[model samples]
Target: AERVWYPLWDAGLKLGHQVGTVAQLLDVGAENLETATSLLAARVVAASSADGEALVDDLAERALAQWKGRSRQNLDQLQGAVAERHARFGEVAFLLEPDIKEARGGLRDVHSLFWVEQATVPILREAESAGLAAAFEMLLEVRVELHRLTGQRADKLLLELQDDVAAALGLADADVLMAEVSAAGRTIAWTGEGAARRTLRASRRRGPMKALSGIRRREVAPGLVLDDGRLELTDDADLGDPLLVLRYAASAARHDAYLQRGSLERLADHAEPLPVPWPAEARGLFVDLLAAGPAAIPVIEDLDQVGLFVLLVPEWEPCRSRPQRNAYHRFTVDRHLMEAAAEASRLVGQVERPDLLLVGALFHDIGKGYPGDHTVVGVDLLTTIAARMGYEGDDVDLLVAMVEHHLLLPDVATRRDLDDNGTIRQVADAVGGTVLLGLLGALTEADSIATGPSAWSNWKAGLVRELVERTSHVLGGGDVGDVVGGSFPDAAQQALLDDGTFVVRGEGLELTVVAADRPGTFAKVAGVLALNGADVLGASAHSEHGRALSVFRVGSVLGGEPDWARIDEQVNRALAGRLAVAARLGDRSRTYRPIHLTARPARPTMTVDNVSSATATVLEVTCPDGVGVLYRITRAFAELDLDIVRAHVQTLGSDVIDAFYVRDQFGAKITDPEHLAEVELSVLRWVAVDF
Candidate 1:
């Protein structure tokens, strides 16, 4: 029904004893010619067969055995050998070793093929001839396709390898597996040496007979074998031209790629450069990029999203790096700075939305370009360049803000000592608002990782905690209570209970608040009740029919208020002049009719309704008004196979929202919103949350 095969090739030495009978017949001059030919062929087949077999007397004769045993013990380094030359060949045909270490049972034989294909897909391709590689423009095409396949993981080496055939063709760590196929369909000995030689031949693509078809020789390297064993071209013109330079560089990259894996010291004497901002023009373009702002980004050329990244790093101190004291530092301040930036990008790649955030982390310290007043000098320079390049508005704003706030992480980390509030205030000040702490937090996490673990400690987590608190407060959660409270007039418009209104004339924070009246009239204020002990917000009023009423709404004021104390005093004086003002110096209160907002739960039971199912690591989350963070608790249950029976999410602002839900998997209504909140808070701390 089924067949098996084995192979053994030992460079034509100590041949199996079957050949012994053939040799004797030849020596005695009594060979039967045709008979001898058949006999020799049978011997070779038997040698490769997995085991010796005998004709069975009965169908169920389990007593018969076909045995084969290992005669030598040099197969220990087999996998390393195969992986080392993975880039050289494809469709490797080899017998399985008696034992497989990493996988279990059939996993070794079946699963390995799939795994090998996957790992090498990013770094290697089906390359038999350079002609095919060139015809497909395999490097560029593969990269685009690979990036699509990887989706969000595009920055990782795995994703980058999809387009890296030029380099992947050279990664010796991967290989295609091949199995010896024959007509006999019987067992055979393993030919480990044959596999190795075939690997070398496949790596070269074509033998001497077909070398000209694809891998033609052309000398490109200087001081190396010119017009000798390897490929080469004599004209210096190929070196100077941009298009030609890219081609040759790609060629070199691929060539070195192979040589590097073979453990060859250096593949070439020159560097392979991608098409990008000319190193010679870097100074002016850097300045231009700083200026062009957001518009400049849309017009970027030569550089892809991955390569456009640049990092700004600190000057190295001799005493600071204890490990590298012995080696002379070839990377000076400028070069080391570049390295730091690169390191930072590598770290940021692992975070969510890293593409957007890493750009700021890279360019944040670029303001050091000027001799003095980096903030002003850099800002001015950036705006000028951006204006020149047709960049303005939000693009310019984003860049300027990042560069301006770049020092926040290091400044806090290296500070003498900073309390939680101080750290939070600093973060809020840099980001323009506490609500943006999530974005800033992502940036901070990337920066810390970019610099490596030695750069931070548990003490640094306190800084993150402060920022989270402020951010959560801004997100309509946490115990922010009222950052800047304002006054509401007593009696809703002759008790009409219809107009939702609030009066906050302090600190430019005018908002329209509306919510049904409940038990906690004072405590349930959603946002900005008081800040720095002053009501820096406006008044709000809301009312429905007499049966259901609450207060929430704020006066809309542009550019916000300035100096709550000054505004409060001015308001008091104006109120005293206008009406009977009983406003005391300290105690203040407001009563207003209330309005209600209906709550609806999200439902996706039918297949048509539930199309997308995303499996993501929970990063950051929130809950609806008067509701705690049910999202986090449900997500935790999801992790533990706890199904959410019902869930609802309500968006209140651009970066803020809240969710509520029931998880039947736990079989109980989560009553303690505070406990849920605490769980969310602890989870936020345990993981530097992202989304």
Candidate 2:
């Protein structure tokens, strides 16, 4: 009874609508089992015919409800049935009726089908040329035969009706809408001229139609994309349909079977195309399949096709001339690619997807089997598989492009002599552009990791590091410098003690001393200060962080003629730029420990001039200066091998300084006054200056 209402509804709702576009709204049911089921198709009942404003508003309300599985006019299979109805009955008028599909599987809910059955009449209809009215009636009779005789009506009848529609248009069925219907569980083909093409006598499953095969999975590499075969695919390998079951079965079967040239030639001649009945004009491949075919490429899709043709044409298995000494290589060329693919699959952080990476890695080295660049060959393999897999055209191209630059990580990044970013960026730019540099970085790491521990070394790993860093810089841009700067901390300020040692400002600077740490190390250091008249405040010595660090914080004593300023300045200048010492000067500085400089009568006395101007003064006198005594005294002092601590001598208009500090027999300072006097008298007796 509901079947009585569909044509009426179609005529009422969309008879005058444009044929090229879907009406204002259409919804398909969401179901795991069936292909799209529920639907709501409508054109706006416009108040004033104002375009999408009215149309979209009408569609949105219904569509939102339909998407959420709440459309009142939803249909489980409206398109298939209505499409068939149109073909059988020609253009029938439809009326606005309650959605019968929402109630039952078929037009069986007759109680809800309370709508008038209206005949379709076009206001500006073209003339019926090839007995359109009679042909349509005949088509409906055939549909009834399938429903009554076979218990089902299928789309094949619609294909037959297409001929009649085209006949009305003065043409044979142009195959524009070829229909195949499954009736009584058998596929039937109908032509446009109200005729059947060929009865698919076998069930649709028995013919070339595919069985419901679940997608197959296989091991691939970290960054290399793999075909379902786990082979690292070349760019050409990114076939739209990787599972090209026929190709894979053939490819896999070849591995297990004996495929000689004679056999291959025979196989090529009979090799079937895509097992699925796809659109004839759909972007596809028809490989020569024969090794000796003159054509390298049967069909090309984007830049990736270059890669596919190469993999297809080559003999990929390796020979016996293997690298005997290498420990990691366990298989021939082809097997290695698969193994690398497996290794690459486990990696993350480097690629967008490990599976994609695995595919790429497998192809990266596969081309090495050929005569020229392996990258080129690998890319070709990728695109071929892409096409075979039925990937979108752009997707196929992207897959191949990845393969073309897979080897660049090693070939360009690592510099034996000098390293730079240009090569890294160039490789990355070629790869998934700047976006996938991180993935390339992961691929680079995987390449090294695949080489195994023994074979991969500092330089090799460094190449990986360079690629990682370059990618980071490119991706991070301005933020990379912040990463570098965060590693080292700023130097803490230190105080400059008058005792030529730096005192750390906040805490003592962890002194690192790499010099000879000897027995007199502490003593000798203390002695030098004592001799220089610097009183030590605090000192600590330790070894740490690959160097010996020593710190001494002391202040200048009243040493060297009580000239504190000169002493401190000289000490600072002496310590400044000393090889073993360095620190930042700050508010926390070292002060000299207090010590006195007392005048004592001795042979020679060392005095520090505190003032800016140079001045000389006598510190010790041997005996009294008498007539000619001064000359004798001076000569006596000179003869005694004594240096006048502050005697300024004018020699040929040049000032010669006779500076002194009295050193004993052991070259020590004469601090004792009595011993100093004895040493002074001895000097006087030697030159007859005084007693």
Candidate 3:
């Protein structure tokens, strides 16, 4: 009810009145009150009146007339109110859990439409109004049911409560309930946004004579023209041309302008269907639209709202407004695809086939809406889509492969050992060649970025990049050692190893430790860094003769930069057995807890892989990420008399995946079954200490 009375009170106070009573405010009439306030008061009075409906109707008409009399002055305030409301409540339509009352596309958006309509001219078409009304009713029903079930006024449709809400409403399950909610919210949000833009544009227009004289129309393409800053079709443009829709969309994106709603409606109603196995020109235009980078997203969204986008790719309908019921994805299936394509456009220069990369990114996750495995289903779906878009046999196959292997890079990079020859060979075989590898590599980065903030990180990017380089070497017929040999003891590190002296160098977030090769050297450095408030993002170790060199990439656990001078001194003292590294780390672990502790911690697991690497046993440990995880794990290996040749440390959200290439005291892989089992048990025991 605040939406109704707050504006009225604010307006009355502006008119130099206390507004102590509703009667005083209503008696002020439309002339003295702001248009937005008058409209809000009209709705409240009309809803509350029983027998005075006719009187309320007269009040509403007077408010509309007054608003029209000073449309320009009123429009700015109304638009500002709408923007402020959106700021308070987010505008995303397909959140895993949605706010039913305040979120964009929620009941408040419907109310915003009503306010905008009363303040300006009619913005929604008759059909659009009907759709918006239905959407509002659905959201209202859900909100009412939520209130009844919870016995309290709760607006957010929480994930855990969705099932109970769905059952009360006689829906099949939570997914079904959420999908319907997404559809309704998207409709209301899109309609509301369009209406707001149109009203704002109308308010900015000049008087008829000045407007006609100053109107600027510049042709952007064959059918599209920039008419008064909006992309629209010229009077002589052809409507029946199949490729015209793509051309218009591309021009709109390239010009960075909003597509005129009237022109969009005309195109949706009259444009012919693109022929199957589309001609080169039509395909080129479609690609060009996708290649417009971030600008293409809003243009594609506008086309989707009018049903024009679906006409080009019918497979896109199922994905539209479909919620991804997980914390990892920040957008709906269709929106994520669009975002991924937009991100991929920026990385086009990195690949040999930018066209395939762009198209592949757009369709990579298209099968999430289907029932089967998304990757498998996506491969099938893209096969048909690629062929229809006029790709040749090999191009179609490559696109299909891209969807099938879209997640391959990130999954392998984060979860497997990149130092292993077998791992590199496996990836090279799956990717087939460098060209597809390049495409998938870029797609992996784009897709992860689009998923959510937690999905992509510099550590993950490094792993993927390393994997791609190693796989590229193998695919190009180079020996695996050619790539692996170049790693570790690189020119800078080899110089540190050759020094054969204790050296602790600290620069920014990177720390390098060179010391005499000894048991627990790596563990001491890791524990010292952790105690110094340095979160070890990644670390690598190498040794030649009696000297060992370790390079660590770290970030501050408490934010800002780490105290490098203190860390450097502490590392030297710990290596000299004077700093009590383990005891200090244990104390810090008791005091410091990870900020993002999940309800269900991942069950710790360890795998001893001997076949992946020829010389060292690849021991991979996965556990919930906590304080000093790498320190504790390496300490266990040192206790077992194992020497860590190399290590890859990565943190993915609440979990950490650490792969260590280790060897026995004699520099031999731990091949005995009992020894392997002991290694797994020891690491798991140490990792569990922090948990």
Please give the clash total of every predicted structure, in order.
Answer: 77, 96, 0
Cα-based lDDT for every prediction: 0.31, 0.34, 0.81
Over 492-590, each residue of candidate 1 has an lDDT whose tens digit, in order, gives: 432434554333333234322233332222122221232112321112222233222322222233434434554444443432344212222112222
Which is the winner by TM-score between candidate 1 and candidate 2?
2
Q: Over 4 Å off in model 2, which ranges? A: 1-330, 348-350, 353-355, 380-385, 388-394, 410-435, 457-466, 476-480, 483-691
What TM-score fits each model? 0.26, 0.27, 0.79
- lDDT for each residue of candidate 3 in 408-494, tens digit (9 for 90 to 100): 898778756676678898898899999999999999999999988978988789889999998998999999877765656678878
Q: Please tell me which predicted candidate would have the highest lDDT against the true structure.
A: 3
Which digits, one per residue and each the tens of the lDDT, describe model 2 over residues 18-85? Answer: 22222322522233202122122343443445775565565555543444352112232332444454
* TM-score: model 2 vs. ground truth: 0.27
Best by TM-score: 3
